[model samples]
Target chain A: MPGTETAYQPTDRTVPTRSRERAAYDRELVHAILDAAYVCHLGFVRDGAPVVLPTLYGRVGERLYVHGSTGSRPLRMAGQADPGLPVCLTVTHVDGLVLARSAFHHSLNYRSVVVHGTAHQVTDADEKRTALDALVDHVVPGRSADSRPANGKELAATAVLRLDLAEVSAKLRTGGPNDEPEDLGLPHWTGVVPVRTAYGAPVPADDMDPSVPLPGYLAAL
Target chain B: MPGTETAYQPTDRTVPTRSRERAAYDRELVHAILDAAYVCHLGFVRDGAPVVLPTLYGRVGERLYVHGSTGSRPLRMAGQADPGLPVCLTVTHVDGLVLARSAFHHSLNYRSVVVHGTAHQVTDADEKRTALDALVDHVVPGRSADSRPANGKELAATAVLRLDLAEVSAKLRTGGPNDEPEDLGLPHWTGVVPVRTAYGAPVPADDMDPSVPLPGYLAAL
Candidate 1:
């Protein structure tokens, strides 16, 4: 029997050892995890301290774009910094809860990606629009075509930062916990506790015009 | 008719201005959101610089606990700090994707908690065990009772920190996007695209003894 072909190459950029089996180097696996997640926890050192902020993000091919108000502290800091701000952007999808025979070993089945880079602020108008469109489409596939584009005032208030997917690592953990042979007979739960996310029936805005129908792209989602 | 009275106060921790009709706030609500999620983005600043890191966390009644190895940079810096580390711990649950008739209004329906406080390290053994149990049970409810308690050696290697619930806020956004009245006739999709989390069938560990039955608590999850 032949073994499966591996898509991810073990390199300096990949975390080949931290979690040997769970870590994946495959590009498709990496992209799937990134694409499925809607928010990214962006970590950066401001002074000598670390701060993490949960924010909206969009991925364009291998590049990731994050937007915020120009007046936001991080945005201002990134724009003014000499070497730009070093940041660790992370996105995670929690698939299930791992129930181990022992509490000490209980874990979660998840997919996560961490990107290390210096993000620079986008200043050009065309680039800004393109990034903004990517952001909107990321949240809603056809949204850029439906809504009015950002006006001058809105554009002036917004700032978009770009970080290429140059140095990144994806870590994953799935399946049951590794229980010791003796501990297995101790009589405890030993399977995945499933976690799920579902959409409830749509609630239209109280002031909705009711003449328009819900879009198919959103309907499919 | 008068509304039902409850013990959990909705005043302080809940947002008064944006009360989510579909959302509920109570101890159960708080615990569920905290337990189902993994990885909290801790935000803090050192020397006027901001930084954030992905770290493991556990939550007890009205308090959230985080731990790191003693050699961890943040732990060392936090131990020496005067007012402890000024930290913001945030956990978010992305419930669904909101598709708006207009691109500008596209948003995500999510439930998130933001906690602001100074984190202090845990030095006492009893408190450490309590916090560790909370962390364990936060991920798996009954397993804490079944597993071997952390021995002295393991406990000695971990550094635990705590943040109270006094300065915490839980914000939630649910349902479809609120499209503008005039934009309704523009023939755009405007409904929620559901996001879901599903679990594959369990794969037992190869080394399991096979004599022990899966516990009811784990099965219930």
Candidate 2:
């Protein structure tokens, strides 16, 4: 298990004003939320305008890595020789929808982590390979070991960028909606509709060999 | 039904260089993706750094509205007297996880829509009310009609911003993973694991009146 003693020191950007009680600085909770979500929205500035792209991400210790084709705009920008790219990467898991008596109180139960920092391109070969493995393992637990590793040409074509988890905060809202005292008597129902991500049976590829059985790790999912 | 005749004109920024075939400019498809996803990552430049926030949003025709507290940074910035905030709003649905024979070929099947434009504060009371209702309905169909509408004080506390759907593009990755020809004989399993956002049974609030019946809209979920 990872150490729980270290907590992220929140910066001005990570601080929450509205519903401040939901904000968490504990590293354990932040790591848990990051680990659970496979995809993250990476925000970056392109020509003074903000651009958000959804992509796969992996976290290792206090560092998070995102890889993409070198030809991609965001990847090329991060790999540039100048100062690193300033990004705010966010991962959110919507747990449920809070149905309140009044429309104003209707909200979502969600856990979200926001990381604000500069991302630098990984130049070291060892770090790049490890990041790639982590990325695969992130989507599927035993995927990296089960599948063939990236070749030299493929590694060269891929760009892996790393961001330190320095300024990060996880905010989550749970339980039922907070309805007004008077609205409780309203005819409408008030409750929490839980939302969950479920995985269906693995569908074999059309060209897959008939003898190949589904892996245990995937079957477990 | 929405007309299928109109299509978004792709600009320099909206054009996709990678997987060009997956890029779509059809307004109908873009709207469908936006409507299906309840939450969107709103991206805006804050103090020269990119900030991406996950928030609830609603769409009406060609405009998308996101509501937040009046004191929130993004809302406040959008309502500023100067030029409106240039924002990128994105909604993504992860349909499935593609497990490929090679780790390098592993990918995801997803549908995502990106809207790039200026977001202006909706000051009109009528529009704000409609947007609020649309937001409630976005999460649960017929919810706005079933629930009590927001009163004056609640409306005062909320701030809604509107973004036009002019600069929009929907990119989707569907079907199975594309593995290398040589990797077809690999022992690893290769397939797509379908993912779905499922809704569990509703949990009534502690203060909910026992006499109140579950709403039909929620029951359908």
Candidate 3:
């Protein structure tokens, strides 16, 4: 899964008319972008209207897995429909604020991945367990090995859905803002204020045993 | 906008099937969650399939505005459709990662807002200008006041769409993970690793005039 090279072919649906130069088809770039983010916006059509909800996701090679309660709308819909649920999943990270001389040119330097495909409910028990493990490890590395695996009851209540990384594109906007030549002379600061996502020290739960200490994996973060 | 109190009536679309206890209909809570995030996932149907896009947005009172080049597919479709574009807009902030004793109970403490409505193309020139100003100011406070406004040509090429906050809900997961009682003694480290978004030092542009310095608004950040 690591160091694999496969560029997805751009389709009519994946192509953007504006700023086409920012789009990328490289597999490594897509995987890196997807791995960096913690959550994704899952979009599906309901009654001919689109509905987008934020949810956690995990990626393993060419497949992405998202899990939710069996009673959840998307999971239920996926199981009920004859065909799989058509969905669009997207992840984005804003790296910096691009401030320009002109307000019109002000923008954000960001990296985003958009995945379009039909998601089918994962049925196999082993695959479901693996997908759930991936989801846990996705939020924090080495997490899956540290925590207890799900039991049969818990596994039954959870529903995992998988989407192949076939129709995917990564778009990125980087560097300083592109201000007009005339506006460059204007008396305004022009630059990027970088944005960073950092993890803070862990806070123990109220009911946790005091004998247990902070783990090395979390302390490193 | 500050200290306003209004509660939205929860409809079936706004209610969550699972974890209903986390849902909130208070307008102030919804506004706070929306204001904290920089980007939103805009979802709409295209050719009977759902499409989700990450875009910049601005909120003014009960209305939200999203803008893009006229050539963009979503913007063009909104302008062409008489009834406007049926869309869903969502914003999410992941505050912390919850590592439970059991892997099944591991989750993220997050605040999210979901909005569903029809987005109409902004037709009035004055509203369009105001909306554009909001977009700039949204990214950086006091930015629109310091920078040059868009000219006629730039204005013509851009389209702004407005969505009223009629159908909205905010969901939040706080505190520690809900691990099962029997798993409390599991050897895994269990706690909340806080996640935070912060700004770094501003990087001046390559060709910027040296005389101009970073503005107070950005410096404070």
Docking class of 3: high
Scanning candidate 1 chain B in windows of ten residues, the lowest lDDT window is B1-10
Candidate 1: residue B179 Cα off by (Å): 3.5
* TM-score per model (chain B): 0.82, 0.96, 0.96
Across residues A1-221, which tens digit of lDDT does each residue of candidate 3 receive? 43355788899888888899999989989999999986999999998999999999999889999999999999999998768999999999999999988888899999999999999999999899989999998899888998899899999999999999989999999999898877778889889999988899999987788888888888777
TM for every model, in the order presented, reads: 0.78, 0.97, 0.97
For candidate 2 chain B, the 10 contiguous residues with the lowest summed lDDT are: B1-10
Better-scoring candidate (lDDT), 1 or 3: 3
* Model 3 misplaced regions, further than 4 Å: A1-5, B1-5
Candidate 3 lDDT tens digits, B47-148: 999999999999888999999999999999999998999999999999999989998899999999999999999999999999999888888878999998
- DockQ, per model, reads 0.33, 0.87, 0.86
lDDT of model 2, residue B154: 99
List, residue by residue over B67-104, the lDDT tens digit for candidate 1: 77676656776788877877878788777777666666
lDDT of 2 by residue, A1-221 (tens): 33345788878888886888999999989999999988999999999999999999998888999999998888889878478999999999999999999999999999999999999999999999999999999999888999999999999999999998889999999988898888878888888999999999899999999799888899878
- DockQ-derived CAPRI band for the predicted complex in model 2: high
Q: What is the lDDT for A211 in model 3? A: 84
Model 3 lDDT, residue A59, Cα: 93
True contacts kept of each: 0.47, 0.91, 0.94
In terms of lDDT, the poorest run of 10 residues in model 1 chain A is A1-10
Cα deviation of B189, candidate 3, in Å: 1.1
